[model samples]
Target: MSEQIADTAPLGHAKHIRSWGNWAALILLVLGAVVMLFPLVILALNAFKTTEDYNMTGPLSFPAHMSLEGVISFWNTTDFPMKFANSLLISLVVSVVGVLLSVLNSFALGIGRVKGNTVILLFIMLANMVPQEALLYPLYIMFKAIGLYNTQWSMIIIFTIIQSAYGTYLLSAVYGTFPQAILEAATVDGASRWQTLLRIVLPVSWPTISVLFVFFFIWTWNEYMIPMAFLMSDSVQTVPLALATMQGQHTMAATDLAAAALLSIIPTIVFFVFFQRKLSQGIVAGSVK
Candidate 1:
C-alpha cells in the first residue's frame, strides 16, 4: 500500500508540474502577442489622427476624431499608387520565378541525385550566407554596365537569384526524403523524368512550395536596402523606398509618417490574409513528412 501510495504521489506531482508549465506557457504567449501587436495597434490609431490631435493627445491616446488628412497627404506626396504597383509587380515576379527555379534545381539535386550535388548545394547555401551589402557595389557596377541600373528589372533578377538559392537548399532536403516507390511506379509506367516531375513530384511537393512562395513574396515586398541601392528613380521606387523617403524629411508630421507606414503595409497584410489558409496547410504538410 505504501509503494502504491508513493507511485500515485509522484503521478499527481507530475500532473501539477505539467499544469503549471502549461499556464506559464500560456502567459508567455499572451505577453508575446501583446508585444507583437501593440505597435501595429498604435500605428493604426495614429494613422487616422491629425497632426493637431496627435500632438495634443499623444500617440498612446486614441484620436479625438478620425481624419484623412494624413493619409491623403502621404498618398499624394509619395505617389503611393505607383509605389504600390511597383512593389506588387516586383514581389509577384520574384516569388513566381524564384519558386520555379527552386523547384527545378531541387528536382535535379534532390530527386535525381545529380553528381557533385552536395558541393553544388553547399555553394548555394554559401551564396545565401553572403550579405547583400557585400554584393552591392559589384551589383551596381554590373547593372550600370548593362544599362539596367535604376530599373525594376535589376531588383527582380537580383532577388530571384537570391531567393531561389535559399529555396533550393530547403526544397532539396524535402525532396531527398521523397517516397521512392512513387518514382519507381512512375518510371515503370513509362513516364519520362520530366513527366514524373510535372505530374508526380510537383503535386506532392506543392505544399512546401506554396510556403516558399508566400515567404518569397513577403520577403521581396519588405526589402529596403537592395531596392534602395538598385532603384534610384522616384517613379521606380518600391513601397519601402517611398516610406523611407517620407520618414527622412524632417518637416513630415508624425501622423503623416504613420499613415505612410500604414499604407505601405496594407498590401502585404492583405496578401498574407488572403493566402493564410494555404500558408497554414503548407506549414502543416511540410511538418508531417
Candidate 2:
C-alpha cells in the first residue's frame, strides 16, 4: 500500500504541475491579447468622438456621443474614394501579375530543372535581399527616363517584380518536391507541358498561390516609401501615402486622423473576412502535407 501511494503521489504531482503550467500560459496569452488590442480600442474610441470630446475625455473613455463628422471630414478632405480605387487597382494588379510571374519562374527552375538553376535561384534571392532604400534612387532615375514616374503603372510594375521574386523562391522549393509519377502519367496520356501545368500543377498548387495572392495584396496596400518616391501626383497616390500626407497638417484633427485610419483598415478587414475560409483551408492543407 505504501509503495502504491508513493507511485500515485508522483503522478499527482506531475498532473498538478501541468495544471499550473496551463494556467500560466492562459494568463500570459490573455495579457498579450489585451496589450495588442489596447491601441485598436483607443483608435476606435477616438474615431467616433468629437474633437472636443476626445480632448476632454481622453482616448480611454467612451465618447459622450458618437459622431460621423470626423469620418466625413476625412473622407472629403482626402478624396478617399479615389484613393481607395487607386489602392485596390494597384494591389489587384500586383497580386495577379506577381503570382503569374512567380508560377512561370518556379516552373522553369523547379520542375524544368534548367541548367544552372541553383545559381539563378541564388541570384534571385540575393536580389530580393537588396533594400528598397538602395533601389530608390535608381528606380526613380529609370522611371523618370521612361516618363513613368508619378504614375500608378510605375507602382504596379515595380511591386509586381518585388513580390514575384519572393514568391518564385518559395514556390520553387515547393514544386521541387512534387511527385514525379504524376508528371510521367500526364506525359503518357500525351499531355503537353503547358497542359500539364495548367491542369495539374496549378490546381494542385492553388492553395499556396491563393495564400500568396492575399499576402501580396495586403503588403502592397500598406506600402508607403516606394509609393511616396515614385508617385508624386495626388491622383496616383495610394491610401497609405494619403494618410501620411494628412498627418500633422494644421487643418486635420486627431479624431479626423483616427477616422481616416479606421476607414483605411476597413477594406483589408473585409478582404480577410471574405477570404478567411480559403486561407484556413490552405493552412490546413499545408500542415497536413
- CA lDDT of each prediction against the hidden true structure: 0.93, 0.91
59-131 in candidate 2: lDDT tens per residue? 8899999999889988888889999999999999999999999999999999989999999999999999999
> Which residue window of length 10 is worst by lDDT in model 1?
12-21
How many backbone overlaps does candidate 2 show? 0
Question: Which residue pairs overlap in candidate 1's backbone?
Answer: none
**Model 2, 287: alpha-carbon shift in Å?**
2.1
Error (Å) of candidate 1 at residue 102 is 0.3
Candidate 1: count the clashes. Answer: 0
What lDDT is obtained when candidate 1 is compared to the true structure?
A: 0.93
TM-score of 2: 0.89
- Best prediction by TM-score: 1
TM-score of each: 0.91, 0.89
Cα lDDT of model 1 by residue, 1-289, tens digit: 9999998998888765656779999999999999998999999999999999998999999999999888999899889999999999999999999999999999999999999999999999999999989999999999999999999999999999999999999999999999999999999999999999999999988888898999999999999998988898999999999989887864788898888889989899999999998899899997787
Error of 2 at 81 (Å): 0.6
Give the C-alpha lDDT of model 2: 0.91
